[model samples]
Target chain A: MAVMQIKFIDKIGEGTINKIESLGRIALFFAVGIIHIFIKPFQGKKILDQIVFIGSKSIFVIALTGFFTGMVLGLQGYYSLVRFGSEAALGSAVALTLIRELGPVLTAIMVAARAGSAMAAEIGVMRISEQIDALRTMHINPVRFLFTPRIVASIFSFPFLTALFNVVGIFGGYISGSVILGINQNVYMGTVIESVSIEDITGGFYKALAFSVVVTTICCYRGFYMHLKGEFGARGVSTATTNAVVQSCIFILIVDYAITFFLV
Target chain B: MNTPLIQLENISKRFGNLDVLKGINLSIYQGEILVIIGKSGTGKSVLLKHIIGLVQPDSGRIYIQGELLEELPSAKIKSYQKLLSYMFQENALFDYMTIYDNIALPLIENPDVIPSRIREKVFILMERLGLRGIENKFPAQLSGGMRKRVALARALITDPKLVLFDEPTTGLDPVRKRKVHEMITEYKEHFGFTAVIVSHDIPNIFNIAQRIAMLKDGGILFEGTKEDVFKSHGKILNDFEMGKEI
Candidate 1:
């Protein structure tokens, strides 16, 4: 009975240590990748490719999300605010929600789903195929060759996407709040303009920027250091992709809370 | 008489519970072909990887051109990488790149070279490899043998001082295998470079290697000339190509 208890405790301890080691490695990977972005020689072509993939390719889905999100916010705001004769504040609620939280969080999560998964899959394949070793042999640093551009592209582009999401979302809110719900159009615009502060807008942009870097870094880390323990084929690639997207989504939410805690 | 191109001294590497290489001591001379033969999974390729700095040893030291590899900073190691390149057992071509781009990668990374020179070299090598008109095609479009040849072309394009080949002829047909042997000889003679090949193709390797080393259980069991290997006695010597026993 004592031996069994010791064995169980040992297993738990080893699992905890391994988890901590993985987290430490990820933190180190992110720090080095970010530092290299500034120190590494700029490759315009690679960064542009990432921007095209992560930014332009994502606009359609983001627009659709923003449209529906805004309409929901408008309808909900009308229903709730009308209960207490506070429906006049519908524009403020819509703009604040779109700008302050939903815009950054939803756009980032979408990117984590689409571009993040693809990036992880791509890098994971490269890892399994020994192409990363080839890059090293050819005197090209794999982190700089692969990760820096991606991280930079994500950091630079996600904010713009968040802004686009907010714009589309606000338009949806305006149509639902004023056009459909019989609210005053001029008052809707006026309330949003009057109530939405620069601090709130900038706060959203900050979240977008931070979330972009975190999401991209997590995806790249997952892809580059693909877990080869379980299996080592197509299944491994799929596992890495799924893990990257899931981990990136969780990181996005956690970082969202942290950024909000300090900044907001 | 020339300085050893690479020297491994009491090197060891362990992957988790397995000791992949143990107390390995080997010297690769300049401008000679040294073939390492071993059973599958005996760490022959792992030894080659250590010389090129892809996989660092757990203990002991490696010297390339008289300087300790681990002693150098990463930037210096990277600079040294250009001087030596390894052809992986799995071709390792970038999937997204075309044949032309794959072959042109080294030159593209080196800022000193002109585009015309890159184009000239790539085109010449492609012609030599019978891949001349398919520059734009991706690796997935090529057969395994063709991909291997293309990988060979990419390895040689940089004109490194030493070229490492891991199982150069295992999966190849007779004609392609012979062709690869010829390509190795031609490239070595043309460029005056050393070759370190790890293989299990006994007869074909005997045709090219000045020295042959057999590995077993993560250690060297035999090291001698091709003639000396046939004359050697032991369980390892009796074993021929790919688990064949005589």
Candidate 2:
């Protein structure tokens, strides 16, 4: 019985050590990648290419999701506010919810699902295929060649995407509240304009920026270090991609909560 | 003879519970084609990786041009790395890049490189390597043999002082393999760059190899001229040269 307990404790200790090591590695990876961005010999062309891939290509999905999200919020908010005879305030509620919370969070989640997974898979494939090693031999910094541009693109992309989501979401709310529910259009627009402050907008942008860093860092880290994870070949790449998306999503929510807590 | 372009002293590497390279000591001379022959899973690629600084050894010292690799500053290390180019066994071409972009990547990344010069060099290499007219095609769009040649072109594009070829002729037919060997010889003669090749094409590789190193059981078993190998070991080297699993 004593031996069993000792063995169990030993196993737990080993797992804890491994987790700590992994966290340290990820933190170092993110730091080095961020440092590379500010170094001389900037990757302007590659950064532009990534901006097109991560930002321009994501517009359709962001618009679609934003519209539906705001519609749902308008519909749901109207029904609930009506119970208190406060349905006239439906626009403020939808605007605030979309701007303060759902806009950055959902946009990040969508981008994580779309672009983050692709980044992980792309870098993971490069890792397994020894392309990253090839870059090293050619005197190219792999982090600069691969991760720096993606991180820079994400930084330039996320807030713009969030802003787009908020604008489209407000339009969706207008469609559902004024057009469908017969609410006074002027009243709805008035309340929406009145309720949103500069703080709310800037706060949302801050969240977008934070989530972008988290998502890009985690995804790139997973892929760049896939070889060190004791996995190889296609299966390793697939596993790394899945883990990148899942971890990004989880961290998004966690970061969202933490930011909201501090902001509120 | 000339302070050995690269030297490995008592190098050892361990992956998990397995010892990949156990106390390996070898020297590579400048301007010579040294082919390392070994069985599969015998750490040939790992040894090559150490020379290129891709894999750090657990216990060892590597000297580049009589200077300890580990003791060099980061800037010096980068300069040394710039002097070397590695061709991966699997032809690690960027699948998303066109053949032109793939061959020109090193130069494109170099801030000192001129745009016109990059195009000129890339086109010349493509023509010489018979990769013309396919410059716009991605690596995945090319055949295996064509992809190998593209990789070779990319490796040679920088005019590196030391070129590491990891199984450069692995997936080629006998004729293509011989052609690749001929190309390596021709290019080596023209450019005068030192070459280190890891291959299993024993007799065929012998044609271009100025010196041969046989790696077995995590250490170098023999290191000398091809004639030295043939003359010294009647059975072991003969079996290895015959593609027998020793």
Q: lDDT of model 1 at residue A246?
A: 89
RMSD of each: 2.5, 1.6
Q: Clashing pairs in model 2?
A: none
By lDDT, the best candidate is: 2
Q: Weakest 10 consecutive residues, lDDT, candidate 2 chain A?
A: A25-34
- Residue-wise lDDT of candidate 1 within A1-264, one digit each (tens)? 999999999999999998899889888888877777777346778889999999999999999999999999999999999999999999999999999999999999999999999999999999998999899898877887888889989987899999999999989999999999999999899999998999998999999999998889878888898854465779888888898898888888898899889876
DockQ of 1: 0.67
User: Residue A170's C-alpha lDDT in candidate 2?
Assistant: 89
Against the true structure, candidate 2 reaches a TM-score of 0.96
* Model 1, C-alpha of A34: deviation from truth (Å): 2.2
Q: What is the lDDT of residue A212 in candidate 1?
A: 90
lDDT by residue (tens digit), candidate 2, A132-159: 9899888888988898999999999999
What 10-residue stretch in candidate 1 chain A is worst by lDDT? A34-43
For model 1, state the Cα shift of residue A71 in Å: 1.6
